[model samples]
Target: MEPFQWKQAAKGPSLFYLSSWMEGEALTAGFTGRDGGFSKAPWQSLNMGLHVNDDSKTVVRNRIAVTEALGWPFESWTCAEQVHGARVHIVSASERGRGRDVREDAILDADALITNEPGTLLASLYADCVPLYFYDPVHRAVGLAHAGWKGTVAQIARHTVEAMTAQYGSHPSELLAAIGPSIEDCCYEVDGPVISKVEPLLKELREGGASMAPNALIADANGRARINLKEINRQIMIKAGILPTCIELSQMCTGCRTDLFFSHRMEQGKTGRMASWIGMGRGEPFS
Candidate 1:
């Protein structure tokens, strides 16, 4: 629940794991910090959001850099035009090049995506909202979700797991979840209305306790509350039947680290997006 950071290693990006989920297969995942991209100024480096006033070409180049840094081919990575809804897409080999050509528009109105095919990289962009990655090696399945407060309150992460189970027969006990970087409670203050909508679910996870009441979670400073997105998502994963030890969360707040990540809330909409992804590999290690 406390803020944490992944030290920048000399070899590559900040790679980490959810102990329960990191077992078995080889997979690499993490957020792209403000370093290692081709953008300048507000966009800075490693900016992955294309609609944030950054050059389209530059975003493509930046994305290639990110994919390559992970030892994955740029051509294999698949992205979507996020619309902040709960719609989930099941990516297939035929849909691999849906949005790469710039000449063709990518699938729209989806906030989450999953794939069971190897070498199929599925990703969802992020700014301040939390990015979650799911993997079920037992089922050879994986999922990615972008949870802004709306999506979080809607329990999109839980939805993804359920979708995986229904579609791919994934058992939560065998699933691994990773919560990527996002706005933390220290910097993610919110109003009472938002807290009111999500309190019931929070309460249910806390064993139906009263500590998660709307007023209890709100702060007096802004006459609102500062909800811990990381904690909220973690609790959702548990309630969805995911083992706590199977979840890995990045405790960094995007808003607080404007110099390292794009925070839409902190930057007031003048920021780029970060990419959080998950994929299943068929023949090679994800590494």
Candidate 2:
């Protein structure tokens, strides 16, 4: 079964809820689609990123719409200036709502955001880059990481788990993880330099007892290869101590689903961005 299930409302942001997490936890965790908001052309309809040249006011409005749809306070929306690094920022009450509207207010130079503070919605913008989510029900902590090829090479997934463990005393065994929609191997092809970085990670996984699938890296004659980023991240999580059975991987490919998602690669760099959000709330679940 697909973990991130899409839910459309008559008049709100069309979002995918991490259904399993919402079923029994006071958590709102999921990704947004490219619909039900206010933005023009390239970013048409529901662009959630303020850094994408969309009108700042319009982007803020779309963000507000998402918060309204999720029943989270717009003031609780916190984000970071994703630099594609493995740096994880620990968000607290003071950092809540830092980057809700303006890019300048966003947390700086961090690709992952982790927090045990309830009611703080940690969001990161994405077009093709992977959205990695982590939830530690035991510590009531949540984390969101932006893993593009660069971040993946830096082992952002493992870094996120380690950060959660260090900051919140979260045991990786108790952390539930999810890899969200992104460009898959079918659509993500890379050159020598990128493949070079990924090779060592594959070696590490194999040495760590995690078997690599044949399709993990499909090489062509031109020194280029298609990489399965989600699987790579999954293996990294397992190598970092998360059980394979506890992780959820989304099969939705942004590159192949332009009708429902915004793909920077598919759109030739001209596109909007979707958001991945996960936050623990006070009492009842919003979704």
Cα RMSD for candidate 1?
3.5
> 1-287, model 1: which lDDT tens digit per residue?
52123434464333333323433556655567767677887877777777777888988888787676666787777777877777888888887755653524676778888888778777778888888888887888888999988888888898999999999999999998888788887787778788687677677767833234242255666668777777788778878888988887776778888877889899888777777756555324422
Query: Once model 2 is optimally superposed onto the true structure by TM-score, how far is the C-alpha of residue 235 displaced, in angstroms?
Result: 0.4
Clashing residue pairs in candidate 1 are 37-46, 118-282
Candidate No. with top TM-score? 2
- Badly placed stretches (over 4 Å) of model 1 are 1-24, 101-104, 207-216, 282-287
- Candidate 2 regions exceeding 4 Å error are none
Shift in Å, residue 145, candidate 2 = 0.5
* TM-score, one value per model: 0.86, 0.98
